[model samples]
Target chain A: MKLNSIHSITSSELNAFFEENRQRTLCYLESRFPVLQEDDIEDIFQDSSITLFLKIQNNELLDLTSSLYTFFLSICINIARNKVNRSHPTYLLSDNITDSDFEPIRNDKLEELENLVGYEIAEEQTDQEYLNWIEQQVREGVRQMKPPCNQILWSFYWDGLSHRTIADMFGMKSEDVSKTQANRCKHKFSDFIKKVIASYER
Target chain B: MKDNSIYNEQIDRFLKGQMSTEEEQQFKTEIGQNPELKQQVREHLYLIRGIKQVKSQEEQKIILQEQHEQKVTPLRRNWIKITSIAASITFIMVLSGIEGSRLYYRHEIRQYAYNASVGVMSDFAASSRGTIDEETKVHLTDLFTNAQEGKDLAETIDELSRLYVLTKDEFVDIEDDCAYQIGWFLAVSYINDGDYEKALEIINNIESEYPDNEDIKSIQKQLVEFLK
Candidate 1:
């Protein structure tokens, strides 16, 4: 395939180009999003190809300085990002947190953490076991957390939503407020885990 | 915590390729200095990659559907016209005491089976899985490509049948979609080769195993009618 503008390429050539890249693109997507269903992956590939074709037809590729595949990749990434954003809302603040609300961990909570780990301190546990314990504790704690706080952490950590987007979706006064609240919730969750460990040592 | 968020935001920008060259260099320096920040950046990158995969798959589906429609519609319309004309010609030939109408119908049926086989092969290629290694993947891809190109279909059918037999015991390890696809392709290949008995046998087996698989059931029905 000669490297040139999209305008010079025939439809058949365009289709051929897509056909050649189709399997490669699918493999790339599969490796990245192994969690996605096969049907969903196929859907994204088809959608991206069509978008690329349309862009080429409309002379949109003329402005693209990178190779055609790179442009196609960007389209795929943008679409995936948007889909994730829509499906997973990050800032569903059922409980809001503030810096002023901070409190020291209770003695009992630390004891609970120690008991859960089956050790005097977290360092006694294997790295994998320690991480798993923390994950389980965090999950349990988040469930009991106020709505927005759990939602904020879930969105930021799991869904990977940006603070600005979280703020807009959750009706926060500003991105700063969302960020601070998220930070507070994170600290609170960590504090719960620490308290549990601390009580074990005491 | 505030500084962490700032670092996270910078990591996000870096991953998204929104950062300038100088900013990206600075971000790299920060990551090198802070192990936690580097880990956070890696996690964010992984998440974004997954999202991209999902998005790309969706786009592929749209493109394939449009291509299928574009390819099938004209052929279907042309088939209708050709069939109508063939039917009229057959009527005239019958009236003229020509004994060739039977042969014509058989040829038409064979063509239909061939087209159906091609369709089944396409579906199989689209959903085929179960390759445990790169060599197996390459082999399967070659077989499918050859089959799709209408090259040595009998060999392709044998390869597919062998694969089915090899993987039959590991059904739990293989996805149902992939298993069904293999059976569908094998049955279709039999139909195309005019092995109605073999086709019916495979179809019946698939139907028994996957009663809810509409594609297999539909193929079984078509094979039954064709055999009749």
Candidate 2:
């Protein structure tokens, strides 16, 4: 039987595939990142499998160019790398690591990072101290933004709500109005950061 | 201001990956030519990343607190424990049921083969009198006697298969009763040797070819049920 597509796989077949490839994925991670604990490897494996399964279920992974094992390995590698980045940021910085250096094979992660962060920051290499400083500045800017602007920006970006949803929440004239307001708020916030950076430089 | 709005819209589309291949290439070319626009894109990206990081930390703290609360609650803990036990029990029960059905079907097939063999032997004895050649008759009688006497059943089955093929080739004018007796003997030998697949195949053939034969029909029905 030629099982080329994910749709053709039965539940039992899927479970068997996961069980068989799980050990191989763990072994791959152990080889690549020996410092990762057994528990961390297991967590990465679980998270990768769940993410892959959900993507397949939702029809997000429509065209698979590689074998299932290759796809699985890529997901595990990406996840393990991200966990390492989060837990050992200083170590990563010492190695002169950057976000762009760890380009994921899966396009979903790339798209997600791009949407959450901007392309430049997503690609830039920086230390944890710089990241913390920028985070502080962003929080301050958000806090100082006038009444509804902060709330609108929070809803649109942080909460991942749509302009239409924000418009409905805040009783705006339309989705276009919500979008315009969001852009204005983003500019205002950006100006706050510029002022802070200018003062800090002086 | 118009250029900034257009640039922001373009940046948004680029970040979201909503652009076509051609548009993306064009935007990339534009970014390469313009350094100030590139800087603006970088700054915007950093701001977005910082905000996301702060929000993510807050969400993580909320998640950790919720998990801690769930662990502290005795009622929730008891419910989770009970559910896990119930699920384990149900899984074991399902596994046992599948194994039980497999054993039951095997027993049914063996019993049916034994009864069918006895009936075929009697029919052979009654029908073989003066019609079959003396030498062929002796050979078949010896084979059946050895099978009944609890001798090597695998050897008996192999001899039965050869005898069946010989009968079909050499005895064109043989009685219908004798021909069917040979086929039945071959099938029952297969069953006794635990070759149910071959036994079922012969039984199905007999049933289809002799649709009016009640005995073959009954055997076919039993084999089908055992298989199911």
Candidate 3:
């Protein structure tokens, strides 16, 4: 059986792919940004993997001209570069991180997947689309939370920006301040969701 | 607030696999024993998942928007917004009818996937690890190519099935995915030969042996999307 470019990817296959590239990807990131902690590097890689998984899940990726690992590696590097640039504004990134990097692969498969998720949820529960409903509340909570809390939580939670990067993005004094603020904002966001859920339940 | 913070941190640790085995065991036991703690943990999980889901949707939108440079329409989820408890019950009844039709619909799925078996050929070509000689490899290629084209499909499929049985029984302990990839090809051949049930059985067996293998799962998902 002759396989062409990887058109279909499974979650486990992707995990294997990520693990296969882990050591070399780590070396590449570390050589570029020595300040990155192992945890940070791990987080970046995991997030990139999740991004790739989401793309595959959403049917936003497939029909690769090159190897699957090559496409995956590009995603990892793109994510890392964005993180480093945000986390260290003083450090100059390249001039030509082009806007035309990758075109999101799209088709009707996304809608099909959405309907599949919806169907699965409906199969599991009947009272409400509570999962999606609560997710909506989370989105609202981001908006309704106090000025900086909304912005802070949006960056930290919705954007998956690191606390230090949040600090840098928001012009906060330090990461500690950012963490504390995020904690407060997260609580408020939780409260906002809890309150709405309580009413809906009633 | 500090208590909530401490509680949330513990949940975060557990979710991120940052907890030690002993600590994780203790946490699980506590959740088992304590209702309030369990609820809190569940709430934390839900909140984090909810936030991430929102993030995922937003990122998808951004990507799609960039691709089309046009406004992506809202998710067609009003059907999912299946309002009212009475309507939900009705929907469930309707769903039960769907469940009944599922098997009937599945044959069509099998037919579509059978036609899509050429994908397995790509899986074979991309692989580099095999002890098979050049002559046998050429023979297999000709067989697959003949099957792929419109020429002598049944005869081609029969020859492939013979090779499949010979290969499957012969390569019991072959290391790595080569054997399984061959199984995948044969399963596709079975489908092509109008033995959808046999193809599914073979697929299920492969899944049982290598539960986490995505190649098999990808095929499964592709087939199921017909139902979806």
Candidate 4:
């Protein structure tokens, strides 16, 4: 049987289609961005899915010519780039490396055509929807925790706030944030996973 | 110092770049030498990264679509009443009930596709083994080659049923991948035999096993009416 293009799918059809492809999308995202933790990957996936769903609902798919996978890849890449930018001002001092030297995929000055094409194909295959779904689930799980847990998580990760700072913010003993966050989130996260697995098992 | 509250606080402080120089140095040392703490830091950092990239372009479209739906057919106008009524009846009678059943069955047909996927993987492994097993190869090739060549679909379908049973038994101990590989073959064979029901049964089983096989679902949906 031939697989049809995503364009022919109605909004409802697209929802079903995205749900089915979620796993493949997550696998592809994880493979592409090994730097991301599993939880982080899942949050990104949720965001992407919400975006895709909204886009379909609004009839905002402007360019019918672009493949769904390609459009999603561009979105995921941009999202990743945005995250990197938000996290830190600079990865490191440029030092000897000049601006022209960091040309992304082209940075490998001696790259062959086959390698380039292979990279493109790999990018094309990455499923942004699945990644977004997983990311959303993790975020939701985190949100259910206490404020201290939430603050510990966000401060440690997003804000890069020190444990002492988090403690000061909460008026708690500074060193307690890490232990508190981990202890609180782990069981809740496990229960969340159990729920997901149960849904799939059915 | 006795409480270790200062050190406990360092976990978040060092990770977020908010610790004092001495505290930061201590945290880095801990990170370098302590595996569990390092892993925790990595996971937390990853979560933050993921949360930051949640937005996508699809959202913009859905918002626009909502606006269009509201504006295109303004309320209190009753302008397209006749068309709307007819469409509504058609949708309820046909699309809602009957089509819903078709969708249910379509889900079932996906199983065949999953089985077919698994069969394909085994075939690959068998072929890649590089041993010259002519008789086995010929038999396997014939199974596919003759699966859909019959004039009478009923007879073909019966044969497909037997083939599915045999294939199912063979793959009992194997992974779902084998089912995926051989599901298409079974599906096609049943379609040829005029046993769309049996074909659909296999498809349904695979669909339950592998919900993501959209290509199989589409094909199964197309065949539902044809076979019936």
Candidate 5:
């Protein structure tokens, strides 16, 4: 459906759509970020939903596309990016980037549609054993990290906390919190890749 | 040039956008000069990208499922199928526990499998063994032991291990209880093989939820004595 047409759906109807997509979105957000918490995820989506709903009401949405999910994902991503930027995240190296001229490419490598279809196919390929193994590894990796680091990182990444708020939540200097987060999580990212490759090799 | 450790840390921070403006400039300049650093940065990006790809795929699947559900003809009997599946699983679990002899056999077989592979079976076999009920460890140890025997422990352990070795070099698939069980077995085997300190260390790290478990308590006691 077109953006204008979809935008006409009532707030209650929009909420129902959000609820329907919640589980799938949660799984996506968790894997993508891996450090966000449930509450944070709920909050981010709640805010996103409200923002989207208002946008539609005000005719701010330029286009809604074919489905509610597409529109919702766009809204969520925009909100997330805004939140990340506002946090003034302290990446150990963020301070080093005095060259404001350098901008990283922020292209989308994964699509919401492709993911859903792929998941249908992947569901058969991923047996319980594999899922169990990956989940266990993730849990163990999280366990090894310092409690605050693990908690805050998961809260932001998996659960969708803005970096600024995460800083406030942890009560650390935002920059230091971000640095600790990035440093602690770097190892997990490497380790996760190694494990996935190892599993595929096996 | 940055020290290897510093360079790695810098690379990590740069990739995560944690670097300061000055440091980020320096990092970028270093990358400009060094092909190796550039490659490391690329690899890091790829890892993050790959994870995002997986996440996106999962999200898409959920959306697809919802759409599919909407288009598909509604089946009034889905609950029946779900209930049947649930019943079957419950039945299998119950059946597994039935007949004292069968339960004993399952427990004994697991212990035997552990003994065969790891060279030491903890008090899982001994009647007088302490009350530490290490359930999680039991499951993992059983799977590893069974896998070692290959073909469900109805076959030779070495032969099974060899046939499966090509699939995954890793000796164990520690899913849920399986990991805890096998980890414990491996730790104990290390101890039995005269690596007391390593055994103590390994056991200490391989945690069980039930600290008060009889088997765990006994192991802790054993570890304390060994340390002494």
Candidate 6:
């Protein structure tokens, strides 16, 4: 499949891409990066998969010229690189390292990595374990949130679709209507998260 | 809760890096000065990241099963044949009021092979007494004690899984070794519950990581043979 075709990517096709490349990617990672253990390799693979999905959704791959596997592996490599640089995230998060945890990469290494991955890597933020935990609630909220709101939030935030595109997709009356709906869904999701977090703390 | 919907668009732009540098700088100043805005920014990040994780997991579910099948259960074509045996494995050591010692089975396949797996788990529990971490040691004792007494099989499996994942994330090789040891007990726990497929999964994975262990190989052979 052409890399350019990601503009119209659908769910099934993306799953097929995953099933097809899943083994080969593991084999590739195991051979190329001996430092990563099995679980770490799987974690990196998942992160890279999400990164690829987000890039495609945002239309950020317009200039890419590599084949699908090459593009995907480039991501895995960069993530593995980051994995090597970090340690057990549980310890990091347990200390509540809020501001100091988002350690910026050195300029020289950052440039080298950015060039290799063909895109900018986010500055290392706080521990991924915390992000992973927060994401768990977000997922539950999305599934249990009111209908149309959940669907609308997914299409808007996740798919990166514009109001016009979402309106066309959802068959809403107009872009303005879709925008209003998307805004409401975002608030509902945010509120959903707030309530859930408060409950967990209690 | 106050209406924070007005800041949604601006937060989205800031989190998504859609803001210009100057806009981002001004927004960062505001966020630094306001605790509520900082909290909102985190929640929005959670929503965006969480939804994307959910979608990735949808794809992940299929691939994980396929990965499991590829590593272990290649004999899935004969799955129906095995299920028809009405297999209900019973560990005699499970003295938790779950039918004292009468090996419960509908078809009565060779009982000794399954017992051989139970023996392996008992030996692992014995040897693991003092050589592991105190934190893991506590769970390890409960895992085997519950297995021996046949207490709450579901909870045992869940706790073992959690323990395995937590130890693995700590990035210590000793914990990895401990986790592999724990896999044997978990596999037996599944076999005890008559969950042969899940048992085969852990055994096969352990075999892949440690191919030379004759005991693990023997357990795998016995499982496949009994299923046949």
On lDDT, the candidate that comes out on top is: 2
> Where does candidate 4 chain A have its weakest 10-residue lDDT segment?
A101-110
- Range of the 10 consecutive residues with the lowest summed lDDT in candidate 2 chain B: B86-95
* Local accuracy by lDDT, each model: 0.48, 0.54, 0.49, 0.42, 0.41, 0.52
Q: Runs in model 3 with CA error above 4 Å?
A: A1-126, A129-135, A143-147, A158-161, B70-228
Candidate 2 residue-wise lDDT, B1-228, digit = tens: 336657766776666566798997787777666765665676666555445433333332222222233343322222222222112211111112353344334433443443334435544654576888889778877777544322455687788777667656754566765667667767766665556688888777666767765446655765666566
Which 10-residue window of candidate 1 chain A scores lowest in summed lDDT?
A96-105
Candidates ranked, most accurate by TM-score first: 6, 3, 2, 1, 5, 4
DockQ of each: 0.02, 0.06, 0.08, 0.04, 0.05, 0.08
For this target, which candidate reaches the highest TM-score against the unseen true structure? 6
Q: Please provide, for model 3 over B1-228, each residue's C-alpha lDDT reduced to its tens digit, 9 standing for 90 to 100.
A: 227667665665555455798987777777667655655654554454444333333333333322222222222211111111111111110133354234323323332332333334433443422666667667766766554332345676677666556656755544344455556665665644445566677778778877865446655654444334
Give the per-residue lDDT of model 6 (tens digit) for A1-202: 3334432443455657776667656755665556669998888777787777766544344333333445676688778766766754432222221222122112232222122221101123223223223434566676676757765676565444445544554567876887677777777776776676555431
- What's chain A's TM-score in each predicted model? 0.38, 0.41, 0.40, 0.36, 0.37, 0.39
Q: What is the lDDT of residue B151 in candidate 5?
A: 22
Interface RMSD of 3: 16.4
Off by over 4 Å in 2: A1-132, A143-146, B72-228
**Predicted candidate 5 versus true structure: per-residue lDDT over B194-227, tens digit per residue:** 3446556655655444454333444455445434
Estimate the TM-score for candidate 4: 0.23
Q: Please identify model 4 stretches exceeding 4 Å from their true place.
A: A1-132, A143-145, B1-46, B54-228
* Candidate 2 CAPRI-style tier: incorrect
Report clash pairs, candidate 6.
none
Give per-residue CA lDDT, model 1, range B148-228, as digits (tens): 233456797888898778657764475555576577666655654556688789889888987864445555665565455
